[model samples]
Target: MPRAVRPDRSINAEDYQHAPRPVAAMPKDYAPGEEIAPHSHRRAQLLYAVSGVMRITAEEMPAGQAAARPKGIWIVPPQRAVWIPSGCEHEVRMVGPVQMRTLYVEPDAAPGLPAQCRVIEVSGLLRELILALMDEPLDYAPDSRGAAVARLLLQELVAVEALPLHLPQPRDVRLQAVCRQIEARIGEELPLEDIARDAGMSSRTLARLFRRETGIGFQQWRQQARLAEALARLAAGQPVGIVATDLGYAGTAAFTAMFRRSLGTTPSRYFETRAPSPAARGRSR
Candidate 1:
C-alpha cells in the first residue's frame, strides 16, 4: 500500500482560500500550546482535530454589517469539529500535540450550511471523506474523485448534529467580569452571592442576567467552564485524579460523575473510545 502524504507544516491555508475548487482541505500539525492568531477567511471553515483538542474563540459578522463582539468559546475534542462561517474572525489554541484537518468550503458550495459558528459532531464517514480529500490536489478537476468526496462531505456537514460545546459570552460588562472571574478561578467553589456582590449586583439580578445572556444558570455556566478546562487538561495527558482535584471536585468519583453527566462518559472512557485505530491513523497520515 502507498504511504499517506505527510502534511506540509509550512503551507498556508490562505494561499488556497480562493481556489477554483468549491472545497479545499488543509492538514496541519501543531505543537502543544501553539496558537493560530485571529483571522478571517472569505470561505467558511470546518475545523477538526483528528487527535488532541482545541479551544477556539470566534466572532461572526453578517454580510454588509460591522463585526459583532466575540461570540463564544468552543472546546473541540477529537470526533468533533467547529464550523466557522465566512468572514468570522477566530483564533485557535491547541491543548496538546494536534493533527488538524480543516476544510475550507466556498459559501455558495453548500446550501443551508450554518450561518452561525457552532460545534458539530463529525461522523466517521465525514472524517474519512476529509482524509481522502487531503490526498488530492486543491484544484482537482470538477468531475474527479476529489470532487465527489467534497460533495459528500458537504452533504454530511449539513446533516451532522450540533454539539453543546459552546460557551456563550455575555454582552453585559458586569456579567463579562463575573464570567472572567469564574474562568480565572475554575477550580474554586465560587458562591453566587459573593460573585454578584463583587460585581456590584445582587444575587437575584446576577442569576437573571446569566440566564438572559447565556441561556444557562450561574452554576450551569460555571460547570461548563470547568468542563472546558477539564477537557483541555485531560487532552494534555493529565491524570483523572489530578484533573478532578484541580477542578475542585470532592473526589475522582464526583468529578467523573459530573464529566459523565455533561459528556455521556467518564474521563478515561471518553478519550479511550474516541481514539482512532492504528489503521485509521495510518490512513490519515
Candidate 2:
C-alpha cells in the first residue's frame, strides 16, 4: 500500500493572524490517507472535524530527539476542534470522508486553549463565523468587520473544553499483532498465551512491547478496550449483560469493575454523568 503523502503547506503566521485576510476554508468533501508530515509551528492549531471522523497521532520531542510512536485520537463530527499546542509534532488520518476546518490562532492567544489534545464543542454562531471568514475574499482590509469577527471567533474558541479519547498503538510486530487480535475478536475472550502465539511472540515479549508502545501492560489495554467497546454498546441501548458477555467478561459485575477502574465510574453512572452527546456525535460512547 502506498503511504499517504504529507502536504507541504505554509503560511506566514504573522501575516495569517494580523493581515486581516479572510480565513481560508477547507473543502466540504475531504478524503482520508492524506499526510501532514512531521512539522511544527509557532502558532497553535484548532483542527475541527466538521463531518465524519479522523484519527490523530502526536509525539512529544525534547532536545530534538524523535520520541515514541504516536497514539490515536478518534475525532468525530459535532465536536468542532482538536487543539494542538504550539511546537507539538503530530500527524492526522481520516477514518472516513471528513469535512474539517482548521483555525490557526496567534501564539499569544493559545494560553487559554487546552494544554493537551481534546474535543471542543462548536456552537452554531461560532461555526457560522468561521464559515463566513472562509468566504471572505483574500486581501481583506484589516479594519473590515471580518477581522472583528475573526477576533470574536478566537474568543469563542477559548471557551471550549477538550474531551479526550486516546488509543495507543504499538511499533513491535508482536504487540501490533496482539492488538489486532483483540480488535478482531472483541466479542470473544482469548487467553494471553494464545494472543502471544498469534503475534508470533512469547507472552513475556508481548508484555514488554505492550508497555513500551502503550505505556500500559497488555491486560490494562485490553480492559480499557473492553470498556470502550461497552460504552458504545450501552450508548446504543444494548443491555448491560449483553454488553458484558459480548466483551467476554464473567458478568455485568466483572464489566462494571473494569469500567470503574479505567474510567472512574460505573457503566450506569458514567452515562448519566456525561453530558449528552453533541448533535449527531454518536459513536460507541
C-alpha lDDT of candidate 1 relative to the true structure: 0.82
Highest lDDT scorer: 1
| Cα lDDT of model 1 by residue, 66-142, tens digit | 54454689999876789999888889998877888888999899889988888877777887888787777877898
- Cα lDDT tens digits, model 2, 1-285, are 322111222233344444334343322335555555656655566776656455566653321344553544434333355777666667776655555656666556534655555656566677666655554544546788767777778778778754434556777766767777897788777888888887787988878878977787787777656755665466546789999898898988988887777656786765452222232222211
- Scored by TM-score, the top model is 1
- Candidate 1 clashing pairs? none
Candidate 2 to native Cα RMSD, angstroms? 8.8
Model 2, residue 190: what's the lDDT? 84
